[model samples]
Target: MKYTDTELEKTLNELGKATYAGEVDVVDKVMNRLKEAENKEKFSIQKERKVRWTIGTMSLAAASVALLLFIGNSSSSQAQNENDGMAKFISEIYNRQSQADVVYYTPDYIDILLGIEGMDENI
Candidate 1:
Protein backbone atom coordinates (compact mmCIF):
# COMPACT_ATOMS: atom_id res chain seq x y z
CA MET A 1 0.00 0.00 0.00
CA LYS A 2 1.11 3.56 -0.70
CA TYR A 3 1.10 6.46 1.78
CA THR A 4 0.58 10.16 1.03
CA ASP A 5 3.57 12.46 1.57
CA THR A 6 1.92 13.96 4.71
CA GLU A 7 1.52 10.48 6.25
CA LEU A 8 5.14 9.64 5.44
CA GLU A 9 6.30 12.89 7.07
CA LYS A 10 4.25 12.13 10.19
CA THR A 11 5.68 8.63 10.41
CA LEU A 12 9.25 10.02 10.15
CA ASN A 13 8.51 12.53 12.93
CA GLU A 14 7.19 9.81 15.27
CA LEU A 15 10.31 7.67 14.65
CA GLY A 16 12.51 10.74 15.38
CA LYS A 17 10.67 11.20 18.69
CA ALA A 18 11.86 7.71 19.86
CA THR A 19 8.50 5.92 19.97
CA TYR A 20 10.55 2.65 19.94
CA ALA A 21 13.00 3.10 22.80
CA GLY A 22 13.74 -0.74 22.96
CA GLU A 23 14.90 -0.92 19.30
CA VAL A 24 18.44 0.36 20.07
CA ASP A 25 18.90 -2.33 22.74
CA VAL A 26 17.76 -4.97 20.25
CA VAL A 27 20.26 -3.68 17.69
CA ASP A 28 23.11 -3.77 20.25
CA LYS A 29 22.21 -7.35 21.26
CA VAL A 30 22.21 -8.41 17.57
CA MET A 31 25.59 -6.74 17.01
CA ASN A 32 27.04 -8.50 20.09
CA ARG A 33 25.77 -11.89 18.83
CA LEU A 34 27.34 -11.18 15.44
CA LYS A 35 30.69 -10.38 17.12
CA GLU A 36 30.50 -13.58 19.14
CA ALA A 37 29.85 -15.57 15.96
CA GLU A 38 32.85 -13.93 14.29
CA ASN A 39 35.05 -14.78 17.29
CA LYS A 40 33.89 -18.39 17.22
CA GLU A 41 34.66 -18.58 13.48
CA LYS A 42 38.20 -17.28 14.10
CA PHE A 43 38.73 -19.80 16.91
CA SER A 44 37.54 -22.66 14.67
CA ILE A 45 39.89 -21.53 11.93
CA GLN A 46 42.82 -21.65 14.36
CA LYS A 47 41.76 -25.09 15.57
CA GLU A 48 41.62 -26.38 11.99
CA ARG A 49 45.15 -25.10 11.35
CA LYS A 50 46.42 -26.88 14.46
CA VAL A 51 44.80 -30.13 13.35
CA ARG A 52 46.36 -29.82 9.89
CA TRP A 53 49.80 -29.17 11.36
CA THR A 54 49.52 -32.11 13.74
CA ILE A 55 48.52 -34.44 10.91
CA GLY A 56 51.38 -33.22 8.72
CA THR A 57 53.93 -33.70 11.53
CA MET A 58 52.66 -37.19 12.30
CA SER A 59 52.90 -38.21 8.63
CA LEU A 60 56.46 -36.92 8.44
CA ALA A 61 57.45 -38.82 11.58
CA ALA A 62 55.89 -42.02 10.23
CA ALA A 63 57.74 -41.67 6.93
CA SER A 64 61.03 -41.10 8.75
CA VAL A 65 60.48 -44.16 10.91
CA ALA A 66 59.75 -46.29 7.84
CA LEU A 67 62.89 -45.02 6.08
CA LEU A 68 65.04 -45.76 9.13
CA LEU A 69 63.66 -49.28 9.41
CA PHE A 70 64.38 -49.91 5.73
CA ILE A 71 67.95 -48.63 6.09
CA GLY A 72 68.50 -50.80 9.16
CA ASN A 73 67.43 -53.91 7.25
CA SER A 74 69.76 -53.08 4.35
CA SER A 75 72.73 -52.54 6.69
CA SER A 76 72.08 -55.80 8.50
CA SER A 77 72.15 -57.67 5.17
CA GLN A 78 75.35 -55.92 4.16
CA ALA A 79 77.03 -56.85 7.46
CA GLN A 80 76.10 -60.52 7.00
CA ASN A 81 77.54 -60.44 3.47
CA GLU A 82 80.77 -58.79 4.66
CA ASN A 83 81.30 -61.50 7.29
CA ASP A 84 81.19 -64.40 4.80
CA GLY A 85 84.56 -66.23 5.21
CA MET A 86 86.03 -69.71 4.53
CA ALA A 87 85.35 -71.22 7.98
CA LYS A 88 81.84 -72.72 7.54
CA PHE A 89 82.63 -74.42 4.20
CA ILE A 90 85.91 -75.82 5.59
CA SER A 91 84.10 -77.14 8.62
CA GLU A 92 81.53 -78.85 6.39
CA ILE A 93 84.24 -80.62 4.37
CA TYR A 94 86.08 -81.80 7.48
CA ASN A 95 82.80 -82.96 9.09
CA ARG A 96 82.05 -85.12 6.00
CA GLN A 97 85.59 -86.56 5.85
CA SER A 98 85.94 -87.61 9.50
CA GLN A 99 82.43 -87.73 11.02
CA ALA A 100 83.72 -88.44 14.54
CA ASP A 101 87.08 -86.56 14.73
CA VAL A 102 85.25 -83.46 13.55
CA VAL A 103 81.70 -82.77 14.70
CA TYR A 104 79.05 -84.57 12.58
CA TYR A 105 77.15 -81.37 11.93
CA THR A 106 73.87 -81.25 10.03
CA PRO A 107 73.69 -79.58 6.64
CA ASP A 108 71.71 -76.76 8.24
CA TYR A 109 74.46 -76.35 10.87
CA ILE A 110 77.00 -76.02 8.02
CA ASP A 111 74.85 -73.52 6.11
CA ILE A 112 76.36 -70.11 5.39
CA LEU A 113 75.20 -67.57 7.94
CA LEU A 114 74.69 -65.00 5.18
CA GLY A 115 74.24 -66.59 1.76
CA ILE A 116 71.36 -68.46 0.02
CA GLU A 117 72.67 -71.76 1.50
CA GLY A 118 71.00 -70.78 4.78
CA MET A 119 67.63 -70.73 3.06
CA ASP A 120 67.80 -74.39 2.00
CA GLU A 121 70.93 -76.14 3.33
CA ASN A 122 71.91 -79.25 1.23
CA ILE A 123 75.37 -79.65 2.82
Candidate 2:
Protein backbone atom coordinates (compact mmCIF):
# COMPACT_ATOMS: atom_id res chain seq x y z
CA MET A 1 0.00 0.00 0.00
CA LYS A 2 2.93 2.33 0.70
CA TYR A 3 5.07 1.51 -2.34
CA THR A 4 7.01 4.47 -3.70
CA ASP A 5 6.55 5.56 -7.35
CA THR A 6 10.01 4.20 -8.25
CA GLU A 7 9.19 0.78 -6.71
CA LEU A 8 5.82 0.62 -8.57
CA GLU A 9 7.48 1.56 -11.86
CA LYS A 10 10.14 -1.15 -11.32
CA THR A 11 7.48 -3.77 -10.61
CA LEU A 12 5.48 -2.84 -13.75
CA ASN A 13 8.65 -2.97 -15.83
CA GLU A 14 9.45 -6.47 -14.52
CA LEU A 15 5.90 -7.66 -15.30
CA GLY A 16 6.15 -6.26 -18.83
CA LYS A 17 9.42 -8.09 -19.41
CA ALA A 18 7.93 -11.32 -18.06
CA THR A 19 4.89 -10.96 -20.37
CA TYR A 20 7.15 -10.34 -23.36
CA ALA A 21 9.13 -13.47 -22.51
CA GLY A 22 6.06 -15.72 -23.19
CA GLU A 23 4.55 -15.74 -19.64
CA VAL A 24 1.02 -15.39 -20.96
CA ASP A 25 -0.71 -16.93 -17.91
CA VAL A 26 1.03 -14.61 -15.43
CA VAL A 27 0.16 -11.57 -17.56
CA ASP A 28 -3.49 -12.63 -17.78
CA LYS A 29 -3.74 -13.12 -14.00
CA VAL A 30 -2.15 -9.76 -13.28
CA MET A 31 -4.47 -7.99 -15.74
CA ASN A 32 -7.51 -9.63 -14.20
CA ARG A 33 -6.42 -8.61 -10.67
CA LEU A 34 -5.86 -5.02 -11.83
CA LYS A 35 -9.33 -4.88 -13.36
CA GLU A 36 -10.92 -6.22 -10.17
CA ALA A 37 -9.09 -3.63 -8.10
CA GLU A 38 -10.24 -0.83 -10.43
CA ASN A 39 -13.86 -1.99 -10.22
CA LYS A 40 -13.70 -2.13 -6.40
CA GLU A 41 -12.21 1.37 -6.20
CA LYS A 42 -14.88 2.78 -8.48
CA PHE A 43 -17.65 1.28 -6.36
CA SER A 44 -16.11 2.57 -3.12
CA ILE A 45 -15.77 6.06 -4.56
CA GLN A 46 -19.39 6.09 -5.68
CA LYS A 47 -20.59 4.96 -2.27
CA GLU A 48 -18.58 7.70 -0.56
CA ARG A 49 -19.97 10.33 -2.92
CA LYS A 50 -23.57 9.25 -2.23
CA VAL A 51 -23.06 9.42 1.56
CA ARG A 52 -21.46 12.84 1.31
CA TRP A 53 -24.30 14.19 -0.82
CA THR A 54 -26.94 12.90 1.58
CA ILE A 55 -25.16 14.44 4.57
CA GLY A 56 -24.70 17.76 2.76
CA THR A 57 -28.37 17.99 1.79
CA MET A 58 -29.55 17.21 5.32
CA SER A 59 -27.18 19.83 6.76
CA LEU A 60 -28.49 22.45 4.35
CA ALA A 61 -32.10 21.72 5.31
CA ALA A 62 -31.30 21.95 9.01
CA ALA A 63 -29.53 25.25 8.53
CA SER A 64 -32.44 26.67 6.56
CA VAL A 65 -34.92 25.69 9.27
CA ALA A 66 -32.69 27.23 11.95
CA LEU A 67 -32.45 30.48 10.03
CA LEU A 68 -36.21 30.65 9.59
CA LEU A 69 -36.81 30.06 13.28
CA PHE A 70 -34.30 32.73 14.23
CA ILE A 71 -35.93 35.26 11.93
CA GLY A 72 -39.42 34.43 13.22
CA ASN A 73 -38.35 34.78 16.85
CA SER A 74 -36.66 38.10 16.14
CA SER A 75 -39.78 39.50 14.49
CA SER A 76 -41.95 38.31 17.37
CA SER A 77 -39.65 39.98 19.88
CA GLN A 78 -39.73 43.20 17.90
CA ALA A 79 -43.53 43.18 17.93
CA GLN A 80 -43.53 42.58 21.69
CA ASN A 81 -41.20 45.53 22.18
CA GLU A 82 -43.50 47.78 20.17
CA ASN A 83 -46.46 46.70 22.30
CA ASP A 84 -44.49 47.37 25.50
CA GLY A 85 -43.64 50.88 24.27
CA MET A 86 -47.25 51.64 23.58
CA ALA A 87 -48.30 50.42 27.03
CA LYS A 88 -45.63 52.57 28.71
CA PHE A 89 -46.73 55.64 26.77
CA ILE A 90 -50.32 55.12 27.79
CA SER A 91 -49.35 54.64 31.47
CA GLU A 92 -47.33 57.85 31.49
CA ILE A 93 -50.21 59.83 30.01
CA TYR A 94 -52.63 58.45 32.63
CA ASN A 95 -50.22 59.37 35.45
CA ARG A 96 -49.80 62.92 34.09
CA GLN A 97 -53.59 63.38 33.92
CA SER A 98 -54.02 62.15 37.47
CA GLN A 99 -51.37 64.54 38.72
CA ALA A 100 -52.95 67.47 36.89
CA ASP A 101 -56.34 66.67 38.40
CA VAL A 102 -54.90 66.53 41.89
CA VAL A 103 -53.21 69.90 41.49
CA TYR A 104 -56.32 71.54 40.07
CA TYR A 105 -58.70 70.26 42.76
CA THR A 106 -56.53 70.79 45.84
CA PRO A 107 -57.30 74.13 47.57
CA ASP A 108 -54.57 76.74 48.14
CA TYR A 109 -55.19 76.79 51.91
CA ILE A 110 -54.56 73.06 52.11
CA ASP A 111 -51.31 73.46 50.18
CA ILE A 112 -50.17 76.30 52.46
CA LEU A 113 -50.97 74.28 55.55
CA LEU A 114 -49.15 71.22 54.20
CA GLY A 115 -46.05 73.24 53.30
CA ILE A 116 -45.93 74.79 56.78
CA GLU A 117 -46.28 71.36 58.38
CA GLY A 118 -43.46 69.97 56.23
CA MET A 119 -41.17 72.89 57.18
CA ASP A 120 -41.89 72.41 60.87
CA GLU A 121 -41.24 68.72 60.64
CA ASN A 122 -37.89 69.23 58.84
CA ILE A 123 -36.85 71.77 61.47
Candidate 3:
Protein backbone atom coordinates (compact mmCIF):
# COMPACT_ATOMS: atom_id res chain seq x y z
CA MET A 1 0.00 0.00 0.00
CA LYS A 2 1.60 3.23 -1.15
CA TYR A 3 0.47 6.65 -0.01
CA THR A 4 0.90 10.03 -1.71
CA ASP A 5 2.84 12.68 0.25
CA THR A 6 -0.34 14.59 1.14
CA GLU A 7 -2.07 11.43 2.38
CA LEU A 8 0.97 10.49 4.42
CA GLU A 9 1.13 13.93 6.09
CA LYS A 10 -2.59 13.83 6.92
CA THR A 11 -2.31 10.34 8.46
CA LEU A 12 0.68 11.41 10.54
CA ASN A 13 -1.19 14.49 11.81
CA GLU A 14 -4.20 12.38 12.84
CA LEU A 15 -1.93 9.91 14.68
CA GLY A 16 -0.23 12.81 16.47
CA LYS A 17 -3.60 14.09 17.78
CA ALA A 18 -4.77 10.69 19.11
CA THR A 19 -5.32 10.45 22.93
CA TYR A 20 -5.17 7.61 25.48
CA ALA A 21 -8.19 7.26 27.88
CA GLY A 22 -6.53 4.50 29.98
CA GLU A 23 -5.15 4.58 33.53
CA VAL A 24 -3.35 7.79 34.56
CA ASP A 25 -0.40 5.73 36.03
CA VAL A 26 -0.05 3.54 32.93
CA VAL A 27 3.06 5.32 31.66
CA ASP A 28 4.78 5.19 35.05
CA LYS A 29 3.87 1.51 35.44
CA VAL A 30 5.23 0.63 32.00
CA MET A 31 8.45 2.51 32.71
CA ASN A 32 8.90 0.68 36.02
CA ARG A 33 8.35 -2.69 34.33
CA LEU A 34 10.86 -1.79 31.60
CA LYS A 35 13.41 -0.83 34.25
CA GLU A 36 12.87 -4.14 36.06
CA ALA A 37 13.37 -6.07 32.83
CA GLU A 38 16.64 -4.22 32.15
CA ASN A 39 17.89 -5.00 35.66
CA LYS A 40 17.10 -8.72 35.22
CA GLU A 41 18.91 -8.71 31.87
CA LYS A 42 22.00 -7.16 33.51
CA PHE A 43 21.90 -9.73 36.34
CA SER A 44 21.60 -12.60 33.86
CA ILE A 45 24.60 -11.32 31.93
CA GLN A 46 26.66 -11.13 35.13
CA LYS A 47 25.63 -14.66 36.07
CA GLU A 48 26.63 -15.94 32.63
CA ARG A 49 30.03 -14.25 32.94
CA LYS A 50 30.61 -15.85 36.33
CA VAL A 51 29.75 -19.27 34.93
CA ARG A 52 32.06 -18.75 31.97
CA TRP A 53 34.91 -17.73 34.27
CA THR A 54 34.39 -20.79 36.44
CA ILE A 55 34.48 -23.11 33.43
CA GLY A 56 37.60 -21.41 32.10
CA THR A 57 39.35 -21.78 35.44
CA MET A 58 38.46 -25.45 35.63
CA SER A 59 39.68 -26.03 32.09
CA LEU A 60 43.00 -24.35 32.88
CA ALA A 61 43.48 -26.43 36.03
CA ALA A 62 42.78 -29.65 34.15
CA ALA A 63 45.24 -28.72 31.43
CA SER A 64 47.89 -27.92 34.04
CA VAL A 65 47.37 -31.27 35.74
CA ALA A 66 47.58 -33.08 32.39
CA LEU A 67 50.82 -31.26 31.53
CA LEU A 68 52.33 -32.09 34.90
CA LEU A 69 51.40 -35.75 34.54
CA PHE A 70 52.91 -35.89 31.05
CA ILE A 71 56.13 -34.25 32.22
CA GLY A 72 56.38 -36.56 35.24
CA ASN A 73 55.87 -39.65 33.09
CA SER A 74 58.46 -38.47 30.57
CA SER A 75 60.94 -37.69 33.35
CA SER A 76 60.52 -41.14 34.91
CA SER A 77 61.01 -42.87 31.55
CA GLN A 78 64.17 -40.80 30.97
CA ALA A 79 65.48 -41.73 34.39
CA GLN A 80 64.83 -45.41 33.67
CA ASN A 81 66.74 -45.15 30.39
CA GLU A 82 69.63 -43.39 32.17
CA ASN A 83 69.84 -46.21 34.71
CA ASP A 84 69.88 -49.00 32.08
CA GLY A 85 73.63 -49.29 31.77
CA MET A 86 73.72 -52.99 32.63
CA ALA A 87 71.00 -53.76 30.16
CA LYS A 88 72.84 -51.89 27.39
CA PHE A 89 76.08 -53.68 28.23
CA ILE A 90 74.36 -57.05 28.06
CA SER A 91 72.80 -56.18 24.73
CA GLU A 92 76.18 -55.21 23.29
CA ILE A 93 77.74 -58.42 24.54
CA TYR A 94 74.94 -60.50 22.98
CA ASN A 95 75.36 -58.72 19.66
CA ARG A 96 79.14 -59.35 19.66
CA GLN A 97 78.64 -62.98 20.68
CA SER A 98 76.18 -63.57 17.84
CA GLN A 99 78.61 -62.11 15.30
CA ALA A 100 81.48 -64.20 16.63
CA ASP A 101 79.31 -67.33 16.58
CA VAL A 102 78.40 -66.78 12.90
CA VAL A 103 82.11 -66.63 12.04
CA TYR A 104 83.70 -69.18 14.39
CA TYR A 105 81.34 -71.49 16.32
CA THR A 106 79.13 -74.51 15.66
CA PRO A 107 75.76 -74.83 17.44
CA ASP A 108 77.25 -77.22 20.03
CA TYR A 109 80.10 -74.81 20.83
CA ILE A 110 77.66 -71.95 21.20
CA ASP A 111 75.65 -73.95 23.72
CA ILE A 112 78.82 -74.57 25.70
CA LEU A 113 79.67 -70.89 25.61
CA LEU A 114 76.17 -70.00 26.81
CA GLY A 115 76.51 -72.38 29.76
CA ILE A 116 79.92 -70.98 30.69
CA GLU A 117 78.65 -67.39 30.51
CA GLY A 118 75.63 -68.15 32.72
CA MET A 119 73.15 -66.33 30.46
CA ASP A 120 70.43 -66.62 33.12
CA GLU A 121 72.63 -64.74 35.62
CA ASN A 122 73.18 -61.92 33.08
CA ILE A 123 69.45 -61.62 32.53
Clashing pairs in model 2, backbone N/Cα/C closer than 3 A: none
Tell me how candidate 2 scores on lDDT. 0.79
lDDT of 1 by residue, 2-45 (tens): 99999999999988987654634478889999999999999999
Ranking 1 against 2 by lDDT, winner: 2
lDDT of 2 by residue, 62-103 (tens): 999999999999999999999898788667655665777665
Error of 1 at 42 (Å): 0.8
Score residue 54 of candidate 3 by CA lDDT: 100
Question: Higher TM-score: candidate 2 or 3?
Answer: 2
**What does candidate 3's lDDT look like per residue over 1-123, in tens digits?**
899999999999999999998857678889999999999999999999999999999999999999999999999999988779657865766777787756565544555654655554667
Q: How do the candidates rank by lDDT, highest first?
A: 3, 2, 1
Question: lDDT (0-100) at residue 83 of candidate 1?
Answer: 57
Q: What overall lDDT goes with each candidate model? A: 0.76, 0.79, 0.82
Best by TM-score: 2
